[model samples]
Each structure stands twice: as structure tokens, then as C-alpha cells.
Target: MQHKNTIKLLFLAGITMLLASCANDDDTAFTPMEFTTPTYETNLELLLGDTLKLNQEILNLPENVQFKWTTEDTVLSILQNLEYIPKQAKTFALTFKATTNLDSISRTYQVKVNDPYDVYYRPKSSESSSLISQVLAYNPAPGQFINSSFGTPEDAQKLVGSTTNTISLGAWGGSILVGFDHTIENVADAKDFLVYGNAFNGLSEPGIVQVSFDTNGNGLADDTFYELRGSAHADAATLTNYTTTYTNPGMHADVPWLDSLNTAGSVVVNSYHPQNFYPLFITELEEVSYTGTRVFPVVSNSGFTNIAALEWGYVDNYDADYATYKGNLLDIDQAIDADGNSVNLRGIDFIRIYTGAQVNAGALGELSTEIRGIADFSMLE
Candidate 1:
């Protein structure tokens, strides 16, 4: 009986030792370790003539990592042929994404080109209400907003002494937003030259033309900006008083205002308006109509908006018409093929329908800030 009790005691002791060993092994195995991503620093706001520098460093990262860079502005880039110039000052961004097996670090640099000196800009009215009056207040020496639809660049010269944008629209679509570049030897030459364009007949909807100024050289417009849109006003003749007033502040509003650019005149707007434009739709583009009232057809499957604001970059190699007048600007619609592939884009941001596109794809992101142009200050002027 004693021997049997001894065996039982020995077995109980063995069981206790096994339990302790299992508890200790479980405690020792529970060491939590993690990896940390790299760190980078860049100038959040850089002006023209400023050198863009990226101070990058890694922390607790494995070797043999990959580094890639991307940019929203085609004129500026890294490890690519695109040249960097601050002409037509706007906001642009560069993203550096470093990836490793364990972790990744992504950094962005916000660059502002062609920033204007305080004295150069005026306090204009809001964009939503009085587009024409606000734009005119900036340089109200003595000029008229000539519709390029009715006459030639010469006519603009005859009316305002300086031609604004090139003539793009026909007799109905109003004038292109172009200005003068020629000098007269005799002070009496053909008052204006002309700029022709393609997609004139192909466009089902009206086009957009924005007015810009090169404040700080660098060939970019960096200061306050105004937009002009000319849509077919069925009763434009009977309408004598046409005005628009943007009611937002800081260039963004919940209800989009800046989408519909009028063709010079046809529609009337007032100066009391604040800024109102769709941020995603930045380009003063010709509205293309495929089927009906909307510019683009809604995709049935992906739930994308039919009319989308396409992000365009410089096209130096383009051989189309108006290439000279348009310069290296991003000019066409960023459309995806039927096969569900994206267009070749230098840098595209928003993918939703702007106020003008006429289709509602859901809310895409706001367009890059560079395209917003400088805020209008002509009100103080």
C-alpha cells in the first residue's frame, strides 16, 4: 500500500513539472518584434526657381529595397526626361514610395510654381457669382471680353488693343481665351493673327477656356486666375443681365461652382459671386458628347461617373491642330478604353464627375491644388 502511494506521488510530481515546463516555454516564445518604415523630409511648399530636395533616410529597414517616384506635373520630374520649370505657376506634387518586404515609406513634396509677389495681384470677387466682372477688375484699363466666335484675333486687337486667348470656337461658341504676341513695325498691321483648332466639328458639347497670367516668369501662371465658359444659351439674346456669384471661401465649396465655363458672353454673371468651380475638372476642355445630355456615358459595371475630369500633362510631341496656341498643355479628355484600361497619364488625380461633366460617378478626390490657380485678390485692387 505504501509503495502504491509512492508511485502515485511520483506521478503527480512528474505532471506538475510537465505543466511548469509548458508554461515557461509559452512565456519564452511570446516575444513581439516588428519593423519600422523609413523617414523622408521635403519642402511642403516650394516656389519657382527653387531647387527641390528630398532628404531620405531609412530606419529598421531591410536592404535591397526599391524606390520609385511619381509626379502630378509633367513639366517636373525625377529620373525622367521631363524638365522642371515654374512657368504657369500652379500647385503640383511628387510622391516617393519606398517598398520593402517588411514595410514601406511613402513621402510627398508639394511644389508651387510661379508664385506672385503681393503687389502684383488684386482682390477679385468670388468665382461663383461674377466671373466676368471679377476677371475684368484685375486689368480694367479699357478692354472688352471679345467673343472669338464672331470675329478674329484682329477684332480683339481692334476692340482691346491686346488679343487674349486664341480663337477656338466658331461663330456661335464665342472667342478663345488668347492674347497678343506680335509687335507692329508700322503701328498699323493686320490688327490680329488667327489660331485654328481641331475637334471643332467633333465636339458635341462646349469647350472650356481659362485666363492665366505668368506672374513670376518660368512660363507658368502662378497668380490669381479667372475662368470663362460659353455654353449654348438658347435664350441668350433676350437675356441682357447675366451674372454669376461664387459664395465660397478659400477656393473650395460643398456645391461645385467652377465647372461650367461660359464662352465669353452669351450668359451673364455679376461680380458679387465668390469662387465656384469643380476642383477635379481643371482643364478648360471642349465638352465631348457621346450620346445625350452628359459628356460621358456611365460605366455600367464599375459604378464610375460618365463625365470625369481628366488630368492632362504637357504634350510636346503632339502634331494636332492648335498645338502652337495650346503650347505644351494637357489638352484631351482622359478616357479609358472599353477593355477597362486607364489612359496613359503623366499624372491623374480625381476620377469622379465634375459639376460640368453632367454624370455623377461618386465622389472622387479633389483635383491637385496646383490647378486651382492663385486665389483672386482683385477685390482689394
Candidate 2:
């Protein structure tokens, strides 16, 4: 009986020790794998091309925990090191998974990518698209340049529904100031807007486009201007920081234009538009000065050269020459000051396009850049 009692006590002690060991294991094992998110916010809004850095330490996960990042859409590209780059302009949901040997937790991040630019205004200019009624509807604003020669200066708005009466930027400095109802945000990989001009055949009258932003919010186009440097901006022959002045000779007299290069040219009398292609709206000013880059026309043995079509980032070039060009589409990111310094513009509210080249298209007299309409690419997409 004694031996049996001793054996029973040994068994009980063994059971008690086993229970204590199990309790100790429960206390030291993994603290139920609780996770506390960091105080920093995860949701963010960023412009396209901006870098996005995520803080992995905020997950409050274990030291050995592994992170897996994924995006719901292809708009954002995620790197293995938790950095991200936006590829498109749109809102996206990004998910981060924090996983350990036994527990896992996930957090979704809301990211908004703003669209670059929207079609703000399309001025009534000469367009050769053969679709007048359809093109007029794309006109964004009612404000048009007035000409007293047509009728009452105020009544003489841009020819609505009429393709014959196109706005003429006569010579070297002839320009039309176009504005956007809203500012156009600059985004990465975005082509911003298009300048639809009546360019065809051997006539690719290129224009130097300029942009401005509404800085003071007073809603006027009196802000500083930046030139939209085209592919020719870096060429040795291209002129930077150029200026031209056009002086009216009145009625039948030709408008005399002189450039900074001392090259004298006249807004000659073209027989096609005998009514005077020089804009008759602003009769108050005898002379006007325009400052911007000068784009030379394609030179050939015949004096008129058909330049190769740029893939993108230009307007009114020989588009039909190459299969790549759809029209004169321009990107806002290509903006630069007169000194060839890049302007980091977030958005722009106004655009001005002027007749850039001073070439004589044989019977056409002096080649003038003619704009038909403008469209924002973001809206089309």
C-alpha cells in the first residue's frame, strides 16, 4: 500500500509540473499577435510623377514580419522596397499586407491622382477640318475677339458657325490669347491639350505657344508667360528670347513687321483674303509687340520645306508627312522661360499662340499659322 501511494504522488507531481509548464508557455509564447497601426495617416493625394514613400514601421508588426504591397489598378507601380510611382491620373486603392509566422493583417491605402488639364477654351480661328458645325461645339467659351471691320466691334464676334471668317494672326507676332475656364494641372505622361490648326500640304506654319497661370485669382490673362519649347528649341538655328513688333500701316498699306534679328518682313497683301487678314478687331492700337521663341519652317531646295512630323509635343507641323502625328497636340510640361530655363508649372489658366515662322509659301505670300480649335486630351479619354 505504501509503495502504491508513493507511485500515485509521483504521478500527481508529474501532472502538476506539466500543467505549470503549459501555463508558462502560454505566457511567453507570442502575445496573441496584436497589431497597432502607427499614428501616421496612410491615405494620400499626389500628382502624377511624384514619388510616394510608405512607412512600413507604422504597421506595428513583429520584427520578422514580411510586407507585400499591391495595387488594385495599374495606375500605380509599387517597388519591392515599398516605394510607389503613379503611372496614370486616377484614384487607386493600394493594399499592404503585413504577415508573420502565425498572424497576418492588411491595410488599404486610398490614393488620388488628379487629371492634368481639361479643355477650358477653344477660340474661333481658321480651321480646315471640313467639319465646321462639329468643331464649333468644341468651342469652350462665348468670349471671342471682336472686330469693327465686320460690323459693330462688340457685335463682330468670331464668326460663329461660319468657316470663312477665321481669326488671322497676321505676321511674326500675330497671336491669339486663349484662356481656360479652369487651370490645367500638369501631370506625368500627360499630353495636356491639342491645338487644331488648318495645316496641310506643303504648308506647316508652326507657332510658338505660350502659357500662363491665374496667380492672383482675379481672373485675368495678365500673368507672366512661359514658352512651350518644341523639339527645335535645342537646335543651333532656333531663336530663343526673340521679339517682334507689328505696326499697322492702315487700310491698304501693308503692316510692317521687324524681328529682333533685324530681319524685316511685311504682312503682305494676300489676294485670297483681300478684306485684310490683319485682325481688324483692335483698331485702337497702332502697334503691338510679341515676345516668345521663333520656330523656323522646314527649309527645302524649293525655299519651302516640309518638316518631318513630330511624334507629339508640337502644333501645325506637316502631320501628314509622318504616320505618327494626329494633330498639333502639346504638353504643358514642355514649358520653359526665355532663358531656356524650365518652368515647373502645376497648372495654367491661359494659352497664347502666335505666328512663329516668317516664310513665303509662294502664292500664299507669307505663311501664317492658322488655328481651328483646341481640345484637352484628358476630357477625350
User: Could you say which candidate leads in lDDT?
Assistant: 2
What is the alpha-carbon lDDT of model 1 when measured against the actual structure?
A: 0.29
lDDT string for model 2 (279-381, tens) is: 5455435666666667665645365455433333456666542124345767788998767789777777777777676665555556555565555545445
The Cα error of candidate 1 at residue 99, in Å, is 13
Clashing pairs in 2: 147-281
Output the lDDT of residue 141, model 2. 9
What are the RMSDs of all candidates, in order?
21.6, 14.6
> Can you give the lDDT of residue 59 in candidate 2?
32
User: Can you write out model 1's per-residue Cα lDDT over 1-381, one digit (the tens) per residue?
Assistant: 999999999999999999999899678543222224444345465455455554455554445566666776332343312234455456777676666555566677776664443223332224321111111111100011212121233332332321232221221112222221211011122111121222111121123233343344333234333222222212233121222222222232332222224422112222332332211221222221111111221123255322222222211112232244422122212223323233322111111111112212233221111011111111112
Give the poorly placed runs of model 2, Cα more than 4 Å off.
Answer: 1-166, 276-278, 283-285, 301-312, 320-326
For all predicted structures, in order, the TM-scores are 0.22, 0.54
Cα error, residue 61 of model 2, in Å, equals 61
